[model samples]
Target: MEFRYLGNSGLKISEITFGNWLTHGSQVENDVAARCVRAALDAGISTFDTADVYANTAAETVLGEALKGERRQSLEIFTKVFGPTGPKGHNDVGLSRKHILESIDGSLTRLQTDYVDLYQAHRYDFQTPLEETMQAFADVVRQGKALYIGVSEWTAEQLRNGHALAKALGFQLISNQPQYSMLWRVIEAEVVPASEELGVSQIVWSPMAQGVLSGKYLPGRPAPEGSRATDEKGGANTIKRWLADEVLSGVQLLKPIADEAGLTMPQLAIAWVLQNKNVASAIMGASRPEQVAGNVAAAGVVLEPGIMNQIDAAIGSLAERDPAQTKSPASREA
Candidate 1:
């Protein structure tokens, strides 16, 4: 697998990071999930991404069990805070000092690791003072619970402010995890430039636009059964916006583009995101073991400028590029 440096840090992770967001502990059986992790490792993936909030913390336990015997030094493990993982108590969420301090220990325990390579705030906590959050992150670094810090779905201004505070506190904010894909370009306008200046790379999630770019969902028809669009657990809700006829019709135009590039629709989609120099890694999750290696093939593949232009034309006016769209919860109440 191809590797790239994460931000300005010397640490490098696999181009395609294995992530378990909606599948692990929720949509798949433990054995199936473990097989997918095995598939990722067999395919040369060394980076694994998860969150404490995923499946109410069961996902981490499953991942920990799946990766029990691997050499820890060889893997780049990441997890997130600022989500209600436990029983949704008053102190269960946000980036408050109490939550940040308490959550990392829980995350470490669940992941079966003493320290995560990078610990990210899942979302911006508008209610908490940014100083409190960054200070807590700095302390986590000093305590060796996490080697680096990052934030997800934060606005450009929020990243700048947080980066400044993290610097003042003596720990670097090296990455930002955002939902990015050929159809979702919100980060390109503002966050990318700000992160570029701040020396932060993007660990983009949903590079397939939650399977919308896979070209399996055709326009003017009902979603195929057993697909994410039909998943009642939560996947259906997250992918519903892209189920519109207009978006689906526009997505259909990419099939020929993928054929010309000698890539599956999903591979083309994943490769499209990695073309950005500021993107350190693109997170890909799979429900089946067989799907892992196919997506990983997109890692080192480079699309020519003409193919890139064709992609833009195919999805023209259907993409979401408004800089105002990259935001987190207005208030993540604990």
Candidate 2:
């Protein structure tokens, strides 16, 4: 696997990061999840990403157990906060200092690790002062709970404010996790520029659009049985926005393009995201071992300029490029 420096940070992560968002702890059996993680390792992937809120925090525990006995220093493990992972309470969510402090401890316990390579704010907490959030992150680094800090789905303004605070406080804010895919280009117009200027690389999630870009969900047909579209445990709901006929049909048109490049549709989609110099890694999730092997093959494959232009022409109009569309909850309401 190819390794790239995460922004300007000294750490290097695999080009394709194994992530467990919807598949681990909830969708797949423990044996299946463990096999997928093993597949990632066999394919030379050393970076794993998860969030405390995934499957109500079970994802972290599963990932931790999956990585047990591996040389910890060889892997770059990342997890997130800023979601409601606990019981209903006022301080149970957001990026408040209290939440950040408490959330890291719970995450460490669940992951069976003392320190995460990168700790991210899953979303901007508008209810809390940016200063409080940044300071709390600095404290996390100071306390050695997290080696670095990041944010996810944050707008250009939010990143700038947070980066400024991080700079003043003498800490590194090295990454942003956004939903980036062949059909989702919201990060292109604004977030990318802001992140590039601020020296923060993007570790993008949903690089396959929840498997839609893989050509498994056909246009003018029922979603394949047991596909993410039929997964009622949040996957179906998350993928509904991309289920429109136009989008699915547009995706279908890319099949020929994939053939021309001697690649699978999913590989083409992943390589497309990595073409952006601002992206440090493309986060991929899988339910099976073969899926992990197939996706990781896209790590070092570079698309020719003409192929890239063809991709843009094929799905350009169908893509979401509106900077305003990149949003976070004003306050994660309970």
Candidate 3:
């Protein structure tokens, strides 16, 4: 597990970070989640990502329970806010000062830790004043409730403005979590450039396109049962966007390149994302220990120029057909 500086901050994190989205609370039981966390730590993943909204706040509890026997100081935990955790009520969520303050306390309690390594606003909140949100985040840093602050799925302008506010308030905005993958290139248009300019490092999510790049999906066939494509809650949006005809065709086209390099499609896809200097880490969601082990190995495989060219050609071909359809929320460069 290679480690990289998370932006300009002094902290260094594992290149392959373990994140619990659906697999923790919604899909796997606590015992299974604990096993997965142990597997990740064994593989040298020091960073663990979670959110207040995932599984209605159960993910943090599960994670906290799992880490009971491990040395807490050895792990760097990250969690997020700004998503509705309830039944879409007015007071249920957002980046408002009330929500930020209350959410941190709840998260800290559930996580069994006094402070989070990285605390983030999960998304842009159009209703809240940016200053209020920035100040709230700064307060958390000052109060020692969180060590660093970040934002996710925010536009380039939002990242710039937020970082400026944090600096003025005497706080460091260290990272931005966005969906970036070989299949998604929208970030290349502006987000990537903005991060480079502002000295913000990116920790990209869905580096494998949610199993599409894992080579389990194929064109002109029914998706295998029990895969993400078959998940009742997880795969609908992914299937509609990533498992579409054009994307699957692109995956098929890249298979030979992976074979030639003695790599799996997922390994090539993940390495391709890491090749970018701006990407600090790739957050992978794994339901089982073997998946975590496999993903860790991908970080070591170097893609030759010819194999990279084949990937580029496959992406080019996919771009030509309905160029608008390939951008999934996870892959938008921003």
Candidate 4:
């Protein structure tokens, strides 16, 4: 597997990271999740990404159990905070010092590890002071709970402020995890540039646009049974926006491109994201072992510049490129 340094940090992560977001605890049973993890490991994926709020904390427990016998020093395990994971208490969420401090212990316990390679803010906490959040992250690093810090889906302005604070406070904010895909170009206009200049690389999520770019959801037909679009308990809701006929038709246009490149649609999608120099890794989620094997082949596959232009043309106006649209919710609720 190809590995890249996460932003300017010394830590190297696999180009394809196995992530458990909707599949680990909600969509798939623990045994199936373990099989998928085994597949990722067999495929040489050393980076695993999860979040405390995923499946209300069960995802981390399952992941920890799955990697029980693996050498911990060889893996780059990452998890995030900022969402409410337990009882609906006011203080059970956000980036407050209290929440971050308490959350790290719970995460470490559930992860079966003493420290995570990276701890990210799942979303910007508008309710907390920026300095308070950065200082709490610095404390997390100082305490050795996490080796580095990252943020997910934060606006460029917020990232700049956070990076500046992290620098002043003596911690490295090395990565940003955003929802990037062949269809979602929101990060390209501003987030990528800001992160590039600030020494932060993007570990993008949803490089397949919630499976839309896989070309499985054909136009003029119902979603395939058990597909993400039909799995309400998993990604159905989030993927609805990409189910329109125009988008599906555009995706269909790329099938020939994949054929020409000898890549599966998913591989094409994943490789397209990796083409960006600022993207350190693309997180992939799977409920089955073969799915893991299929997607990881995109690692180290470089798409010709001409093929990338063809992708843009095929997606046409379906791509969302507005930098302003890259935003987080205004409030953190339990």
Q: Enumerate clash totals for all models, in the order shown.
A: 0, 0, 4, 0
Q: What are the Cα lDDT values of the candidates? A: 0.94, 0.92, 0.83, 0.94
Models, CA RMSD each: 0.9, 1.0, 3.4, 0.8
What TM-score, over all chains together, does every model reach? 0.99, 0.98, 0.93, 0.99
Model 2, position 290: C-alpha lDDT score: 89
| Residues 8-72 of candidate 2: C-alpha lDDT, one tens digit per residue | 79999999999977589999998999999999999999999999988889999999999999999
How many angstroms is residue 77 displaced in model 4 relative to the true structure, after the best TM-score fit?
0.4
Instruction: Please write out the lDDT profile of model 4 over residues 219-330, one tens digit for every residue.
Output: 8999999898888785788899999999999999999999999999999999999999999999999988889998999999999988988998999899999998888889
TM-score, candidate 4, is 0.99
Error of 3 at 212 (Å): 0.3
Query: Model 1, range 1-334, lDDT digits (tens) per residue?
Result: 9999999899999999999776899999999999999999999999999999999999999898999999999999999999896888988999999999999999899889999999999999989999999999999999999999999999999999999998899998999999999889999999999999999999999999999999999988889989999999999998998989899999999999999999999999999999999999999998999999999999999999999999899899999999999999798842
Off by over 4 Å in 1: none
